[model samples]
Target chain A: MTEAIQKTVQPIGVATAALETKRLSAWFGDLHVVKDISLTVEKNDVFSLIGPSGCGKSTFIRCLNRLHEETDGARVRGEVLIPGAGKRENIYAQGVDPVSIRRRVGMVFQKPNPFPGLSIFDNVAAGLKLAGVVRRNVLEEIVEISLVQAALWDEVKDKLKKPGTSLSGGQQQRLCIARALAVRPQVLLMDEPTSALDPISTARIEELVMKLRSDVTVLIVTHNMQQAARISNQTAFFLMGELVEVGPTKSIFTKPKDSRTEQYITGRFG
Target chain B: MIELSSRDGVRKFSNYFWLAMLCLLAFTAIAPLFFIFAYLLVRGWAGLSFAFFTEIPKPVGEVGGGMANAITGSLVLMGLSTVFGVPLGLACGMALSELKKSAIAKMLRISIDLLTSVPSIVIGLFAYALVVVPMRGYSAWAGGFALSIVMVPIVARSTEEILKLVPASIHEAGLALGLPRWKVLIRLILPGVRAGVTTGILLALARVSGETAPLLFTAFSNSFGYRGLSAPTASLPVQIYTYATSHDETWRQLAWTGALVLVFVVFCLNLVTRILTRRTV
Candidate 1:
């Protein structure tokens, strides 16, 4: 673990960071999964968290949305602040509504869960409808635009009425992306979004992620190191529930500042 | 040397033996249903007639009327029961699945299970005492209330089980969209489990359509047709009981026809539910 400290992190401009965690630590039962970790994600930038399984990467992402509400002895001592649409707002305050934060910050799971019961059109419009959009024509337009933006319009435009589960694996993942985008969330958190897909499907999603970075800030947790190098502007490396190092993607790969990051990157100790 | 005691051989034999036993059990269980159906048709078919459907039952020795009033009575009572029962059952099921942490949800589930286990006769007595005694007379409404009591538990249990079967991943996806809990349940979870809930409701309807015990004290018996909910009603099972025990063979024949009609309606309900589910699946 000591080798993790020397991993090199590229110095990037601080203005890009949109959300920052001061000193976040999360626990499940007696097990401390995420131990005093802090990281920053820039607005309209892609930040990839790469680590081995059971390294607290997934747990860390779940905490951001309060999905695994730290109600059962699960506590976060540090501050997680996201710049408000106008003014600064403390996201980690006790009085803050998790639902409101969740609206601005959305999540996509590892599998291609496309709400099997709903049609493709409804799948995209689900978030909007939930936020109380009732007009049919407007919903129709958002559905079309979201599907198009997710790069899934051409394939499913004809069968918008079909069940979302009818699509192929790659298209289903893209549909999930479209569903997430429909609500117009500012930040998107993806947990191993392509881990369940085939190589070709993975590539298409990878391409979509790159395209999405221009509009929404993306914080992804992935096991694929190469994927981090290819898509993310910044990369954070974790090992044994601790963030070993974080830096620009290129610097993290070529000259890691931490030895643990270096060992893990070189396939020495995952 | 022969290797009869090998692990692979032992595993193979045991697997095949279990499979054969399972198949035999399945066949044994299904065979009785066919036998019962055949028996009913044989005895009940001879009673079929227009008068059997349109007329009331006769007295001790005379044979002139049928079970027409009972048939309509059964339909009206079941319809009323369904109108009262289905929505409440579905709502309770939705609440149990979507609101796992609420105290009301837990209590609702417990009550539903308790209601289901309550004997049919007890339900009849309860309804008779509460509804019939209150009105100072037996009425179709009392019977419908009893039937709805039975229907609610069955529908609620089925709905809960079916909603539980819907993948949590689906709910998570909806929640990820920032949808409130109720919207997630109504729009996403409910639709996913719709087929199973419908099947359960049909099964409940089938149960109520033929029930005689609960309605005995509630709806009582009216040889003539009822006008609506407030009046005494005729139902197939209660009327069948009334006719089959009489000395008149004509009344007995009419009773058989009523029985046959009840069976046909239940069978059709089951068939439609199956076909609907199949199409959706």
Candidate 2:
């Protein structure tokens, strides 16, 4: 089963960098949370960010989509660039709308948040409707495709009309993934997407994330070091708002250069 | 051992005593509602009939009469108030919740709080000057306008409270979906708080339904049924006030019937609101 899955989850042949951030810094009021950091993510690669709690890993990914600065007192000073239709576009440029930036980058939160009042089908269709796809048949087709891609179609096919909250915790998380996928974004950001689930659910989400690498670049923030070593092609370790080290997942786990990275991976210290 | 046992017995006696006392206090608080309901039912039972709902009041010496005009008039007045009050209140509430730290929001909140505490008679006088005087006569428009003012503060505060109860995470989730802020509010947040907003609207309606002071100087009840929005109108509260103090025995009996109907309507509204809000949460 594992070998067959690995064959299907092979990387799409795109070696160019999909996203680049230069000298990125963020602050809430006067307290700087994400210090100066630079990173690059390759197209169709599963990149995992592993760090201790409150280490600014989540904040860094949020900056990629401009969601970090949505808080009242929050501020960001950085250059985040994404691949546009034919050119690289700076997301923070004067005329660029954050809404458009967010549309290109989808996010799955730490907890499953399928809109409470919406049905299973509507939850997946919400993004398309917002983007002005009004045809009923179009919405149905895209919703079905997205759910199938998220690996939740078979379980939810007969109960699409039920409220989103009626699903189990694991199913709800997959539903959220479908909701994000329905928009067909170029990049997917996950903030500890499996921290709230059981072991079986966690494994299912990790498998789905691996399969998703063929279509979209994945950036995941997780505290689970084993998860980072398992699914990620490249892993970045953050400590105290700084990127201590980043390298191929196998090398980072086997022979990390930085003492902090080695200590954290060995369970010596957070 | 005897001394310790006696002390324990004393403590148990005091605990029972306090429990009984609290139950008595709770019963006392609710006793008047039952008394009023029972009195109205007993006094108003004979006045209730098919004609009472379908026919207008008769002259002083007539044997058969009804308060049909007052019933329809009250409906018109309350309906108008809801149409104006609910939307304005909801808008103000959204502003207050979204801009909680802004100076303008603080000022508006204080002003609404003051408006809520202002005497209803004072509001009646203000409406008398604002609408009745300008229109050159007392009319149902003036009455509805006055009741709406009374309703605005209640609706606004309750709406703010209820909207605040919605989790901030929901708002964040909507925004993260690339939805514009307005779309998030309308499509996502509003639907999430629908039951709470409905409850606030119903509570405001119930509050304004029995307000006699505001209508006294504005609508200035007419003996005939509703003529038009520009003309004077009769309402249950004002009609009951007029009949209860009259010298005729028949008018006083009809006044009790009007009171009973008003209470029943408000009771049903409150009951429905409670059920809706309970199920939503």
* Candidate 1 lDDT for residue A58: 87
* DockQ of each candidate, alpha-carbon based: 0.51, 0.52
lDDT of 1 by residue, A186-231 (tens): 8899999999999999998899999999889999999998999889
**Which lDDT values do the candidates have, in the order given?**
0.84, 0.90
Worst 10 residues of 2 chain A by lDDT: A7-16
Off by over 4 Å in 1: A1-16, A70-77, B1-32, B54-65, B99-110, B272-281
Q: Write the per-residue lDDT of candidate 2 for residues B169-275, one digit (tens) a residue.
A: 67767777788877877777777678888899999999999999999989989878989998999999999999999877878888989999999999999999999
Off by over 4 Å in 2: A1-15
Clashing pairs in 2: none
User: Model 2 chain B, poorest ten-residue lDDT window?
Assistant: B167-176
- Model 1 residue A139 lDDT? 98
Q: Could you tell me which 10 consecutive residues in candidate 1 chain B have the lowest summed lDDT? A: B1-10
The alpha-carbon deviation from the true structure for residue B151 of candidate 1, after best TM-score superposition, in angstroms, is 1.4
Question: Which candidate tops TM-score?
Answer: 2
Q: Clashing residue pairs in candidate 1, if any? A: A3-A259, A3-A260, A4-A260, A6-A257, A6-A258, A7-A256, A7-A257, A7-A258, A8-A256, A8-A257
